[model samples]
Target: MTLAHQTLALQTLGLSKSFGGFRANSDISLCVARGARHALIGPNGAGKTTFINLLTGVVPATSGTVRLLDEDVTRVSQQGRVKRGMARTYQINQLFADLTPIETVGLAIAEREGAGARWWSRVGQNSAVVDEAEALLTRMKLGEVMMWRTATLPYGKQRLLEIALAMACKPKLLLLDEPAAGVPEDERHDVLDSVEALPQDVTVLLIEHDMELVFSFADRISVLVQGQLFAEGGVEEISTDPRVKAVYLGEDAHV
Candidate 1:
């Protein structure tokens, strides 16, 4: 895909993050093309999560600039960033236990559509919000079980629901922190399929360790090592990079 005309969904220039004296991410420069599926891959303790935290404003960066759709969002607060069309799902599930799938999605849609002020209004009576939630669930293929409590769903399904919630926000860019992490081997394909099915308009930046899923979904892949970007290229190029193979890919160097 030509990114020349598409605006950047996210970009970081000279980004650095530190915990006390140790740098978690240093001088990281990357750009995700608008609507592109970009992946960040590194082994554990490689600071992948820390970089994500800095981007999402969960942790402040020690230095650098973050641009989201041409707006400087480096120091933007999380909720403010959400309102600015950036949304993310945690590596671990963050859903409310008691809320049903429909209720959870309804809340997300309401938040995005600015209906929270009248949240006391009946759930069923809120036609616009309810309809939006229903449509989102239907698109996710979860409409039939929309009334089931989130806690009752299996781990993989819960992950899909989290993605559904992020979608409800109608984000211009979605940051997925290991959407396939922890799922059974048999169910990983389904989770990846659901992610692949999202609207092309929603650009995705994912941090994942699963090479197969990363290669299958990402249009471009960035390999990070020791808080620095080691390489950036398409799947084949990243897979064949000797530096990347020596560091992360390991024994399966030719993947």
Candidate 2:
């Protein structure tokens, strides 16, 4: 898993963001190698979310450069980034409340396949999109609830559906913003397993607050505090870092 010679999915050099006199992110420089499971963690107000926004082109950086697949994309629009194999989920699930998991994912599949303009007319009649949607939901272990309305599903299942929706994009690099955020404790395992089983070739960068999930899922971690990279290393290195302990994890963090 040494990334030294691996191809990079993303590289940000001196990336920063500021609004008026307040600097939300400062000089973040990091690399996410192709197929790497990377996590960015920090305390509240640590600027992790801000950095994600900058990385995904939802917000422009005040300074720095971003390269995706070694191609400079510092100025790419947010939609433009999605076209270049970047996809993301949100801290809060963005779902069609009334749509069944199958329908929701079918729309995404249809969209990705360039049939979205006729989505309403294509539903139920399009075997290809329907079959693809079923396959993805099954892969996420959501087949049992494929017909359930998203709003009526358990919080955990809702999260799983969102991930499935993101996967429908067939992204080479996926960014997950707190995929496990609101799941009830009893159902967390399902969400965790779905993420663990993502295709090996799809690189992931997640912003999460769940330490156990972070340590278990990520191969590499970057700690950002006050919008700057406070620490970077393997799980063992970060788990033992005194500065990280004091700044983000506190004394109770297992690592």
Candidate 3:
């Protein structure tokens, strides 16, 4: 309860969510310090995704306080939350198939910054917005295929595009749901780096299955098991703890 030194960017106390007879999240509490790279790891059914839904207002929290920058956001709607500088990406690729990659990213920037208000007015015409979108594409490593239709790009590019879209919002914190999932094994490293390279002021809370990426990126790690928080610790402590290894790491020895 005492968060004096915590400098929490986002915090949840005694959070829970239920669907009919099933409890998706139970008494889950976490504090992500301002600018911290926090990673959440768990087995397949641990309710990691559901927890994110509750925080982002995609689903209402059954009971709890959700705070952003020390201000309560438990009841704020999703769209309102985005305007307040919260953004996220999904497990599945979410992009406009018919639009060119540049156009799609352009729309996201416009939506977030209100620069793309004139839809019928030439999308690729705004010099400032186009410059910003192109830079984002380059930073996210999607420059080579900037002109390709989103649907035509490779899976990895599509995934990167989603991140770019989130960045357009200029969010203070980004919630990434399994970013490396479905990305090629060889390309996972770069994708992880792209995430790390994001603005230091932008805190990240990610759900990831790749142990190597998780251990390398997370400043802190929290384990979820059967819809409850099993443990929370700094990177080294979580990686070495026997209980964490038993439940989440399994046969894979700690890296």
Q: lDDT of each prediction vs. the true structure?
A: 0.88, 0.88, 0.87
Q: Which stretches of candidate 1 lie over 4 Å from their true place?
A: 1-6, 249-255
Off by over 4 Å in 2: 1-6, 119-121, 249-255
Candidate maximizing TM-score: 1
Error of 3 at 215 (Å): 0.6
lDDT (Cα) of model 1: 0.88
Clashes of each: 0, 1, 0
- When sorted by lDDT, best at the front, the candidate numbers are 2, 1, 3
List model 1 lDDT by residue over 143-247, tens digit each: 877899889988888888989999889999999988988988777776888899988999999899889889988989998888899889999999887878878
Candidate 2 TM-score versus the reference: 0.92
Tens digits of lDDT, candidate 2, 201-247: 99999899989999999999999888789999999898888888887
Q: lDDT: which candidate is best?
A: 2
Q: Which scores higher on TM-score, 1 or 2?
A: 1
Model 2 residue 154 lDDT score: 88
Where is model 3 poorest over a 10-residue stretch in terms of lDDT?
246-255
